[model samples]
Target: MGRKKVLAVIHTVAYGKRLLEVLSLLEADFRLQVVFTAPPHAFGDDVPAFLARLGSVVLPWAQATRMTFDLALAAGPRGVQYIDAPLITLPHGANYLKRVTEGPNAGVAGLRRQDLLPGGRLPAAVVVPHHAELRELARDCPEALPLAHVTGDPVHDRITASLPLRAAYRRALGLDEGQKLVVAVSTWGADSSFGRFDALLPRLIGELPAPRYRTALLVHPNVWAGHGAYQVRSWLARCGQLGIGIMPPEADWRSVLIAADWIIGDHGSVSLYGTLTGAPMLLATSSEREINPSSPAAALAAHAPTLSPTHPLVDQLDYAAQEYRPEEYAAIGSRITSEPGRFNRNMRKLMYGLLGMGQPAHEPVTVPLPEPLPLNAWAPGHGEVSA
Candidate 1:
């Protein structure tokens, strides 16, 4: 039989990367087609450019909308109006990253919280990262539940799977045997570590002992697009001149995480995911203290030590290396990482079920398909599904 044609739509680099990784698992069974939507906001202009660096096939939106396919997949809501096929939403930022302290505007300050569906844009299947996320979706957009599937973030599957590639990645970076690797990750905005560090490369070179420590950078794609790639590249070149290793925007962050001994970052998913590695994380912003007490960002901030330019970097690193506890970060890990073999299986089950194909090879998960709940179950005085 011919493979099913699947249209994968992406608008942001983060969503693009996560959806790409998940789609890779279905390669043998699906004939994948990709479409890149125009950037919707200020930082978006860099998305297609960033996707190009990753060697992705980005169809023009005009052409993408005209194409026909059996299944459509996306990580963002922007795809809702474009694809005619049964839409599947594999949301990009499963962990909430945002200005939670900022009242209504507190929804993921950097990127749109793609998981929350609008009143009328429910997809055929919305794959969420965890049960808490599913609960969050139900509370906010229960209309999407009938189509929701509680599969852990597919990116976590890629991250856990990349653990074995660490040594190879280190070698590719030409690391010496004994040097401790410190990766400073900068997400976009003035609040992030990249923005906080005026002379980031120099500060890192000065604070971190060279013979014993090596520093690398993973700047967010939005930063590149926002600041202009030429300026970002020029800065990276300056960093390279100072003997700092830098990961290009296109580099898989999981690879960097696997090689990192410590991570210094601001409020973003990189920091959120870094916590899962049990590495002592130093946050560059104090804004995290203002995040909603019940929000995931606040949960992460409970453990991350705030970093300041004047703080003693080496002393903190040493203390963290010795005192870091994996158990403290386990809650975060549980939310992101799935049961080892469950992600692909659940994806296959969902796909096959949607396509009217036969049963998938994987066994059923412990949680049964969720029943549509009353709005009162989560919030008082709200109505049921909007349709």
Candidate 2:
């Protein structure tokens, strides 16, 4: 045989990023031929720009499906069902917690019967973060049970590995010593954090003491894709001018989550991940049916305090901090990944096993996230400047 071939499918900004995290494990292997395809998605913005920076030529979707590969990897189900190769479906976020709010396939986010076990056909494998997800899969798509594997969460692993670098990450963001970072995080759709507390963005500037607090935003990549980056940035321009810096979708958000002292978010994956920061989190919004009640995101929502607009935002932030106990967040954080640091190893082993290839000889390494860039460094666009 010449060499094994692999195809990476980019379904959306979120799915693309998750694929890269897992693909990083196979990067050093020269025996593999890998190419990527940006599949059509409702939110496909920035995917081409993201893939272009890697200096790899991306195969167009139509051409990609025509070619054969040893294995295909996808974080979303968008175009993977058509690929003529063994496929692995990875999680784009925490535990497939979000329910699909619309469309015919709309049901549980990840366990859509038509998507995973289309016409009673199963993907080669479906990798979930925890065993709890297996129960979810059983309830939703029992046909996928045997195909499911709990290799743990790579995103969680990266953050767990990078926790000690918190101080350095904070400094990289240009935070003054006394300033506590408050991150406003939101997932896309009408039930997200910004969807509810959008007015709170402007309020952050007026409510909190500037010297003691630094505000930033971590908006879901899909939101940026749905609303053009220019428009998203423009909408929040005034808030940006006041103080809050927006974390670009492509930036290593784990670093920002690491640096945060408070997390004001909804039931998004980031809030679930925020548990690791030991940063007290306040849910900016909550909808009865937006998330699975048993999912980790729900566990977090059930425990974390809701942000009350009637109360002073600062007082809520203060109360969350003063009443904070590591054990509480730690319990929620534990639900994220049962295998923790084993993600890289387990994933590598599973991929190599499927590819029928041998593992590399070198010791495994988890690269620490690089320092974050300043807000001004990634200005949404370079407006015309006077010479």
* Backbone clashes (count) for model 1: 0
TM-scores of the models, in the given order? 0.81, 0.94
RMSD of each: 10.8, 3.7
Q: Pick the candidate with the highest TM-score.
A: 2
Residue 72 shift from truth in candidate 2, angstroms: 0.6
Runs in model 1 with CA error above 4 Å? 1-3, 30-41, 47-58, 99-119, 289-295, 337-341, 359-387
**In model 1, which residue pairs have backbone atoms overlapping below 3 Å?**
none
Candidate 2 per-residue lDDT, tens place, 1-387, comes to 587889988877788778878888887788988888998888996888777766666999999979888999888776676788889887888777778768876778878787686446578888988888877788878889998888988888888888999999888888988888998899888888878655777668888887788888888888888988998888888877776787777666778888999999888888888998889888888766788777778778888888887899999999999988899889889998888888888888888888887899875577777777764454542211100
The sequence of per-residue lDDT tens digits that candidate 1 reaches over residues 1-387 is 465667766666666666766665554444434444543656566566555654656667777678766777776675465566777876566454454444554443222244445335557887766666555555556676677677766556555555666667566556679878888887676667787667556668787877788787777767866787678768667666766765555445566676788988766677777866657877766354434344456777767676655667888777767777788776766656444437777787787667667754545432211122211122111212110
Cα lDDT, all candidates: 0.62, 0.81
